[model samples]
Each structure stands twice: as structure tokens, then as C-alpha cells.
Target: MAQNDTFNALLLQEGDPRPIAEVSTLNPADLPAGEVLVAVEHSGLNYKDAMILNGLGRLVREYPHVPGIDLAGTVTESSDARYRPGDHVLLTGWHVGERYWGGFAEYARVHGDWLTPMPDTLDARGAMIVGTAGFTAMLAIEALEHGEITPGTGEILVTGASGGVGNLAIALLAALGYRVVAATGRPENARHLEALGARSIVPRGELAERPDRPLLSERWAGVIDSVGGDTLAHALAETQARGVVAACGLAGGAGLTTTVIPFLLRGIRLQGIDSVQYPATDRERVWQRIGDLLPTEVLERCLAKEVGLSQLPQRAEALLAGQIRGRVLVTPTDH
Candidate 1:
């Protein structure tokens, strides 16, 4: 496509009480200043994308914005030595969706430093399937491993188990020989979670409520918690001695009303994971590891649906309501 040719994009415009999301057309010249131009093949729907889609969280300070947090595609132009035309690339973090134009468009222009050369093991579609959610999951697991947690230590608990990060975490941990226990509010998805490599399922009620006591019976050797609030408090209370908990998201709320007894008595370690703005130097290595570790079948199974740019508004509502089960891919050009 020529630089002046129009392409479809999901545009968020300022509105009465919230932002209005719509499908609009734009030329490459309309994109913000950047070093690399990419033809976005696929972008992933994430929690933050949902917030931006509906104008929640005050994530976007400007109108007429694109709101996809991560994407995979091939470069069409570059002004930087680190990238060249036709090179496959993927991007996540660096606040592209929030503070800048992102992959909700058929094309995106971004800083060369914000892009990772796509691994050969993954094509555009496959890379987006393992998008930001999987990227964060890998980071969480790396933290667990760095804390000396191993498969033989005991069961690894994944909270928000039916969501994107939790689902991928179970699959990755199981593939690495760790027994994974999935925790979710929807009991109906137990079979699905188990199929994704969860050895067992725990009801969300088991951990969602605030801990009545400062400590509980030791269970998980490690935890990949996407849900904060009471779920985190409960998880911390029950973590085994020297256990590690990788805190990634706040789908369950951001408050922490627990005591430090878990950290003091059992030596539990709570590590916060920041996928956004995570060093670009380490991204390519992590993406390669995700490609090497997560099986193709598992990755494919984790995909919940694919929607065009026009469908994002309603899908965003579903996602924020906790109705989305796994990863959702966005086809920017389809609309």
C-alpha cells in the first residue's frame, strides 16, 4: 500500500462521559512520528485495551487514538539501522496504546527501539496469539525460577486462571513439568482450563475472599497472580515457605489489605511484573523463549476469538465484564 492510501483503524474520539470508539480511515501520513512503519497483521485484545476502548482508567489523554497494546507484523519502512523494510516484528509495552498511536490500525509507526524482531518460530498470527498476556506470563515464570521455585517444589497456583495470562501460564508451567492449579470464578471452564495443562481447578471463592487470618495452610510453591486485592492476600497467606508470587494484573482490584506476616514468617516473596516498559533489550530473548516453550497446539487453543476493528467496542465491554475467557485477536484490516 502506498503511504497516501487509506487504511482502516479503530479510532477513539472524546465523548460526553466516555470516549466513542469507531472504525475510521487514515493514511500513513496521519500516524505519529516514529522511526519504523509496520503493516500490522494482528493485534491482541488486552485488559488495558479494554480500558482504553471504553475510556476507562484515563489511559488515553488524547482523542482520535488507537488502542491496541500489542501487535505482530512486518516492517514497511524504517529510518533506523536496527530494523529494515520487510523484517518481521512484534511490539508490546512502552505505552503505545495509551500515550501514542498503537496497532488498532492496519498500519502503525513506532520507535525502532520499541520493536522486537519476531522470532522465526512464530509467524505474525502465532506471535499475536502469544501477545502481551503470554509475554507477561513468561516474565512471571522467570521471576519464579529466579526465586528458586521448581516443578518438584510443589503445586504452582495460577489465579484468574481462565484469562489470557493465567491460561498461558498454566500451559507453560505444565510444559516445564510443574503441576499447575488454576483458580477461576467460572467453574464451567474447568474442563477447558484442565485441557490447557492445569492439573486441577480451584474455585475463585477459595481465594477471592479476604483472609480471615494472617496465615493459612501452606499450598502453592509459587503463584502467578493476575488478580490482586483479596486474591493476592489469600495467596500470600497460603504460600509455602520461601515461595514466590509474581503479581502482574489488577483485574480483581488493586488494594492490598494483608499483613506482612507471610513475608516475615514464611519468607514469601511478592514480585511485581511490569510488562509495559519492560526493557526492550530483554524482549527478543523472552519472545524466543515463549516460542520455544509454548507448544503450537496449546497456543492455538488459547485463542478465544478473532474480531475486526469495528467489533472492538462491544468486545471491550465483554472483556471488562470478565466474560472473555482467553486471548482475543484483532484483525485491523478486516473492517
Candidate 2:
């Protein structure tokens, strides 16, 4: 493609009360400077993406920004020796959408270091199906294992189980032979959660409120909690002795109001998962593991919907409202 060739992208511009998101046309020259230029095939619609699209968080410092944190595509040009034309790759984190120009466009120019070559088992679309959420889920599981929480230990609880990270966590945990209890506010999604390998469902209300006591009944052997705040506190309170809790998202809230009783008495370990700046040297192995754990069928089962750039503004609103479930894929070329 020529530098002058125009492509479509969802551009975010400053608005009075919120950011204005619309599909705009741009040339390759308009992309931010980087060592590699990729022809983006798929991007994932994540919580962070929604926040950026809606201008909730001050993620983007400048206007006319592209806000897609996760992308999978084929390299079209490269100055970096590690990547070359026609190389399939995937990217997540490194504050791509927040601090830098990101992948909402049909093409993206990014530092070669931010990209990971796609695993042989995963295609561009499948890699995006796993995306940042699935990557974080894998990291959480690894953290739990490091804390000695095995499948045979006991049941595992997945908070925010209807969301992307929680859905993938439940599927991955169950695939690894652990019994999973999914926690969600939407009771209507119980059957859907079960289909994604949740052995049981826990009403969000049961854990949404602050725990009356510092300690609750011992239940989960380990937990992959995507909803922080009261739900995290509740999970900590009910964790079994020596259990591990991987705290990831803050969809519920960021504050944690809990006592140290679970830590001191039950020996619980609260591990924080950050996929954004995860070490690049270790990404390839992790991606391979994700590819192995999440097969095509599992990914398809978890996918909620697929939309184009033109549809993202509305979808972003629905996602933040908690109306969206599972994963939502974005096809930049569709519009």
C-alpha cells in the first residue's frame, strides 16, 4: 500500500462531555512513528477500550487518537530485524491505546518490541479472540499455580464471570480440571456461564456487599477475581487456608475494604495481575500456552459478538453498562 492510500479507523476526538468516536479515513502517513507497520485484521473490544472510547479515563492524552489495546495482524513493513513483511503477530498492553496510537485502524504502526509473533496454532482472528483478557486470565492461573493451588486442591471462584476475562478464566480453569464457581449479577446468564465450564454459579449480590465479619466460611481453594472492591473482599474472606487470589480487574470498583484476617489466619496470598506491562521476553511462551489452552471451539463458544468500527461507539456504551457478555471482536476492514 502507498503512504497516501487511505484506510478507515475509529478516531476519538475531544467532545464537551465525552469523546466523539467516528469512523474516519486516514493514510499510512497519519499513523504514529514506529519500526513496524502492520495490516490489522482483528482487534478486541476490552473494558479499557470502552473507557477510552467514551473518554471516561484520561487514557489518551491527545485528540484524534486510535483506541484499541489488543490487535492481531500481519506485518506489512518493518525496520526491525525481528519482524518482516508478511509476519503474523499479536500485541497487547504496553499502554498501546492509552499512551500511544493504537490498532482501531485497518493498519497500525507500532514499536517492533511490542509485538509477539503469532503462535502456529493461532491465526489472527483466534489470537484476538484470546486477546488481552485471555492473556490476563492465563497470567492469573500461573500465579495461582505458583502459590501451589492445583486443580485437585478444591473449587475455584471466578468473579465477574460474565465478562471476557472471567469467561476465559472459567473455561481455562475447567479445562485444567478445576471445579469453577462463576459469580455474576445477571442470573439469566447462569446457563451461559455453565456452558463455558462453570461448575456452579454464585449470585453477585451474595458477594457484592461488604463482609459483616472479617472471616467467612472457607470455600474457594483459589480465586481469579476480575471484580475488585466488595467482591474481592468477600472472596478473600471465604478463601480456604493457604489459598491464592489473583486480583485482576476493577469493574466493580478499585477500593478494597477488607481486614488482614484472611492473610494472617488463613495464609491467603493476594496476587495482582498486570498484563499491560508484562515482560516482553516472556510473552511468546505465554502466548503459546494460551493457544494450547484455548482451542478454536472454546474461543467460538466464548465470543459474544463481532462488530465493525462503525458499530463500536454503540457497543462501547453497552459494554460499560454491563449489557455485553463474553468477548467482542472488532473487524477494522468491515467498514
Candidate 3:
């Protein structure tokens, strides 16, 4: 049987540290049972991917696995008629990198249902740059739009504003003409966030130290909250009457210790943003808007680091410590 070059991807064994992806020659035997096999070009590093890499989280139930949740590439073979060879594609979520093989490898074999044909204009690298983090940010923005963010509405607050989703939210909201107040624990990144279009910077200490109150001074009309727990609660207490908050990640903590005053008395609306299992059509629509709204400059501001697959393990630790900002894209071929 003819062999092809096998690509490298980050993998974690059941009980190992300092795990690194290895590149090995591949035969048809290595592919999972799927209708489509795509030659992946770029993959994204997400917080969850870090969790999997460090073996600190339950995301990866098994070992000897690829750990990227987002990938963009071209189709090499497909049994699904909707797809054919040479078509570019992007995959986000779908229990990939957890229950099944993921995009960290040089190739990804996934089911047709889990794949989205890449928008005609976006190539593989560009798409991965907008990977799961940007996708989640766009979804949060979409939820906020439906909640009615207008210029008349006061400033919008973005918690965890230095992270991938938070930064993207700041840029997208600002692009939509809403004043954005970015909150970050790192004072050093104030100007960085500001350049990404945050109208103001609120130190994480200031917001995270908010006193427990039934309601706070109504400071924001809209909020893109990635830091859950007390930060999310404080944001709720301070949301303008009839304002909306989109709660996505739990970077602070999962539990929301909040009173119903914001919802019952002020009529505040809280929308949960989940990108992992979002419907395909909905995902495509968001991708289309991402292609249009996330222009090169905006994307550039978000691209914090680019590391080869060999460098993923250490980078994963940095991400888990919240030491890295913006977004990190992984190129398997950079070795």
C-alpha cells in the first residue's frame, strides 16, 4: 500500500505531562471512520484545548488523541456528495478533540454533519485565525444585537476583555458603533485593548471587587460577559434597565451568585451563549458575518502568537495561566 506523509498534532496520554504532538508517516489505516478527510492547514489554540493538553480537564476522555477544537483546510476525499475534493472547509466544536479526533493533526477526518464548507472568500489560515474563540465572540455579539444594543444604550461592558473571546467582542461591538468598556486584570494590556476599539478600560480589580448589592449604579446598557461567577453577577447588578448580557465562558468561575433584582425589577435579560453545539446553519451565518466583519486589521489585533505544533505544550500552560492574550494560531507545517 502506498503511504503518505503523516502530519503532527498535539496528543496527551492518559497520565503524561509535557506531551508533544509527533509527526509520523501515515497510511490509510490511521484515519477515523468518516465520510470526509481534509488536509488541515491551520488550527486554533483555545482555553479548552489547553485543558486537554495539560490533562487537567475532562475534555479528552481518552488518550493518544489530537487536541484542537478548531481547524480549517481543504477536502481531500469525501463520501458525502455535498462535498468534493479541493473544497475548503472549517470545523468548530462538534465534540471533536474530545470524543473524536480533532484538527490539530495535519489532517482531519470528520463526519459531513460536523463540517461547514468554508465561505468562498476565506482561505484556511484566515479561517483558523477566526476559529472557535472568534466564533464564540461573534455569537455573543449576535445575542447582544438581538437584545437591542443601540447608540442610545450606554456603554457596553466586556469582561475578560483581554482573552480571545473578550477581545474579539470588544472589536466587534465597537465596529457596530457601541462604546465598549474593556475589563482586564492585566493593566499592561490597557492600551492593547483600547487599540482593539475599547472606548474605556476598567481594571479587573475594579470590577471584580464590586460590592455585593441588590443593584449597582447602572453603568452599562449591554455586556458581553466571558468571566462568569461574581464578575457576571456584578455586571448584572449594574446593567441598565432592560439591558441585556450575553454570558459565554466561565473564566472566573462557573457559579453565578446573583440576585433576581436585575431580572425581576430592572427587567434585565441574560442570554447564554454556547458555540460548541450551535446549529450548522446558524454557525454558517455567523461565519459569513465573520468573513465580512472581522477584517484583516481586526484579525491582526487578535492574533497574539503563532507557534508550531511542537511548541503547543508549553503554550498551553501559558494560556491556562491566563498569561497569553488575544488569540494563538497553531500551524502544523511550521515544524
* TM, every model: 0.98, 0.99, 0.95
Q: Considering only N, C-alpha and C atoms within 3 Å, which residue pairs clash in candidate 3? A: none
Off by over 4 Å in 2: none
lDDT of candidate model 2 versus the reference? 0.93
**Which 10-residue window of candidate 2 scores lowest in summed lDDT?**
55-64
How much is the lDDT of residue 278 in candidate 1?
93
State candidate 3's TM-score: 0.95
Tens digit of per-residue lDDT, candidate 3, span 1-335: 12565555555556655444554444556767899988889998998888878776577776677778998888898899989999889999888988998877787788999998887657777788788888888888887778877866789999998899888888778787889999999989999999989988998887785457889899998888988988888899989999999999988888877777889999999999889899986777788888877677778788889988778888888987899998998897785
Off by over 4 Å in 1: none
Q: What overall lDDT goes with each candidate model?
A: 0.92, 0.93, 0.83
lDDT of 1 by residue, 1-335 (tens): 57679988888889967798889889888899999999999999999999887778899998788889898899999999999899999999999999999999899999999999999788889888889999999999999999999989999999999999988998889889999999999999999999999989999998999999999999999999999999999999999999999999999998999999999999999999999989988899999999998768888989999989988888888988999899999888787
Instruction: Write the residue-wise lDDT of candidate 2 on 149-219 in tens digits.
Output: 99899999999999999989988998888999999999999998998899999999998999999999999
Question: How well does model 3 score by local distance difference test?
Answer: 0.83
The positional error of residue 188 in candidate 1, measured at the CA in angstroms, is: 1.3
